[model samples]
Target chain A: MDTAFCPTCQVIQPTTGNVDYFRLFSLQFSFSLAVEQLEENYQSLQRQFHPDRFASRSATERRLSLEHVTRINQAYQTIRDPLLRSEYLLERLGYRVADPGQSEPQDPAFLMEVMEQREALEAVDLSAAGAAQQLGRMREETERCLEQDEAQLARLFASCLPAEAGREAVCAPELRQQIVRVNHRLRYHRRFLEALDQAEENISEQGV
Target chain B: MAYNERVLDHYENPRNVGSLDKNDPQVGTGMVGAPACGDVMKLQIRVDDQGVISEAKFKTFGCGSAIASSSLVTEWLKGKSLDEALLIKNQQVAEELALPPVKIHCSVLAEDAIKTAVADYRQKQKSMG
Candidate 1:
């Protein structure tokens, strides 16, 4: 029974989605990261489990390699973007963000502000140079919003993580509430970026 | 997944595609957003003194399924008594629309909109009294 095959060794590493991404990447579990080091580690891991390296290994070993590679890719994706990283951190802290069941409330005044921005974005003349400027402006505003949220997220996580590094992050009710609000607003930032990208693509396709 | 003809038909020719004056005493407004997909829906109904819904309107910024769901509910709400409206479940909307599993959230949103609208109306009536 060849039941003890691991991609790295005889030890089976935890799966990416289920485990802490920092642990998955063999990095310290903090919001701040040395991106170059992350990239280097990712490349090294990918090279080690590149499937070709496991072609002559046992079938179980090959399967394990594939699983590791899938997890590695997923972890990389989750950690690559600040918004996604913040979401992942919040998730690890046991909040589902905007889960339908939990349905957290957002500030109505803030929502009205976002809606007005959307209306302005909708009215942009994509055929004109002003379109690019308009999109850029909105994108900047969204990025600013994201940056502010990320700062808040980092502060919240920093406060919680140091006290309980060995166990699940001990989330205060205030932290939970803040995380939910930030996560909800993060959707708007993401939507703005997506909309901007689509508009830009259509404009480029039309050569306008 | 490819939308079936009925879903597409509803999407293309949506019913009650407008807004109600939310400030109006007779009107009840339910505005909901699905944080999962970032879809927002606004559903409104005008209830008569006898508690019958006489008019319904909806405006939704979402996928075709969500739009169709809101549209279908508006049509259903027009002739429904408040009690009947309260009883209309999301499953009924899903069944009527032939919504696939992935689109079930849209139906849920529709049902929620109805309940919220009723709740809003009741609150307004209470405050008035």
Candidate 2:
């Protein structure tokens, strides 16, 4: 079923069908996308589904417009954020990202790295000299890690596209494993960034 | 969401909230992470010459439940032998803390941390012997 209007009636359709977010935005199933283009698409979709336009129409049409708008907002929110977008794409391919504290045995070395980073962040004396500079450096480092993981995700996702234009895509086990690996790294990066933000908040709260 | 009294207690005044030397042959270290909540947990155990867990410590960066889970386990680790510590389960942790359904994973992480720490200790012993 089309995400927007019915083919025969040209009327807004109910959101019962499982519409992939990429299809809703008419986008290819890839991680790397133009944010500006996505913004324009989102704005246009919002205009098309604006519930106010259906105020004079049938009751079904009004309800359908509201549903479509809600779905569009959710889809846009998911695709606009890189971490969420990657997770959504993986979900589309039938991969379930492990929930917090439910992860498999991750690499010990990586966990140690994460532990050290968190420990360093925890030990920072916000009122100490050059604290702001230290926080800035940490934020930049975490952001760099996020960018690297995103770039790797883009490459991996591109490799797993369907062979033909309309064929169903099959995700090989190796690809899924790599995707999961990068997803975990992205999650860690996000956590570290949060820690950095908390440290900065601490400094400001101290009136330093 | 409001944490139960037990979870809050552990979170506010976490027990054994520190680190042990990973290089110490008598110390075993386990590091684990939950990608779902972006929580990392590091659990360490120091074994006595008699093979009993003499001391335990943890450093967790996560939600209240996670911090409490690890903190609670460190307390449990003391006075237990390595083999006995391996018997500890996430379910027990969850039940003790009265963790909400969504926060059960925090207990699972603590369980994994214990197993990993024990494994690390065993590995070091084998290499030394």
Candidate 3:
């Protein structure tokens, strides 16, 4: 039902492969990004590659726009979040939390901490009124831990990534270890936050 | 969102939801978590002299699928010998629950919990002997 896009998006730029998400969105290839600017760029790219602009074109051109639009959305999601972006960068630099695939996370100490938190959450009194009091305090604890993980992420990223060029050059073993630790820590906090949300839902479902 | 009837029944009235004494020599405790979802399950089994599971208990902090999975396992564990219990597999539990593909992990966790609890019991037996 359409055709005639402007010259700006005549072709998808990274057709060859290994498209760095940060660079795809006109941002430096680093852990930190101006999230607002990233969102702005995402919208602009989506507009540029809007499928409606390609319907009247050849079949291949139409299909490419569809594919490119999906890629743009994926890149936008990866680049916009601090946690996901850190994991992405760490993987790009060859840091793997599970080396042989599907193995449990190797850090026993961290999992022990996760276990304790879960235990504490489950032990809370489920009585409606008490649940609120317990969950509120639990929320503060989880939020505080989440914030600390985020601060660690920021610190690691700030140290590992320069303001300009050559992300590969910065992947020293020490930095890789730091990134992996931060990534694991970040996952723990993210998962805890998710659990806290589920707990709150269950409590409120009981009208607590 | 159409859960299997068996799964719903189990979730609504989870069987054997509690703790067993960790200090008891006959009680083997298995605690596990899935980092992907932050689901934690603690399953305990009391083994008699013949290695038959005398009683089973569990406390799970997770979704309905996980709760159903653990409850189903505890029910299966009672009266089964430790050797017989080893034959249990995640696929069987998944099929029994008619769990959707995404919730198959719950079944896997259930299977893992069984093996872990039994292993803990055996280890204690060996230590005391």
Top candidate by lDDT: 2
Give one digit per residue, the lDDT tens place, for model 1 in A1-208: 0222355676533343456677666666667666887898899888867778879877876787888888779889989877678777777777765354444563645554555566677678888877877788888987898788778767766777654445656778887777667666777667767877888888888783
If you assessed candidate 3 against the hidden native complex, which CAPRI class would it receive? incorrect
Show the colliding residue pairs in model 3.
Answer: none
Instruction: Tell me the tens digit of each residue's lDDT in model 2 across B1-129.
Output: 989999999999999988889999999999888877778899999999999999999999999999999999999999999989999999999999999999999999999999999999999999999
Kindly give the stretch of ten consecutive residues in candidate 3 chain A with the minimal lDDT sum.
Answer: A97-106
Tens digits of lDDT, candidate 2, A5-41: 7788898877876777877787777788877778888
RMSD of 1: 3.8
What lDDT is reached at residue A87 by model 3?
A: 73
Clashing pairs in 1: none
Candidate 3, residues A106-146, lDDT tens digits: the string is: 35456557767878887777764678778888788878886
| Candidate 3 lDDT score at position B91 | 95
lDDT-wise, the better of 2 and 3 is 2
Interface RMSD of each: 2.8, 2.2, 4.4
Q: What is the fnat of model 3 with respect to the true interface contacts? A: 0.18
Per-residue lDDT tens digits for candidate 3, residues B1-129, read: 877899999999999999888779999977766655556788899998887899999888778999999999999999999999989999999999999988888888888888878888889888999
By DockQ, the better pick of 2 and 3 is: 2
Candidate 2 positional error at A29, Å: 0.5
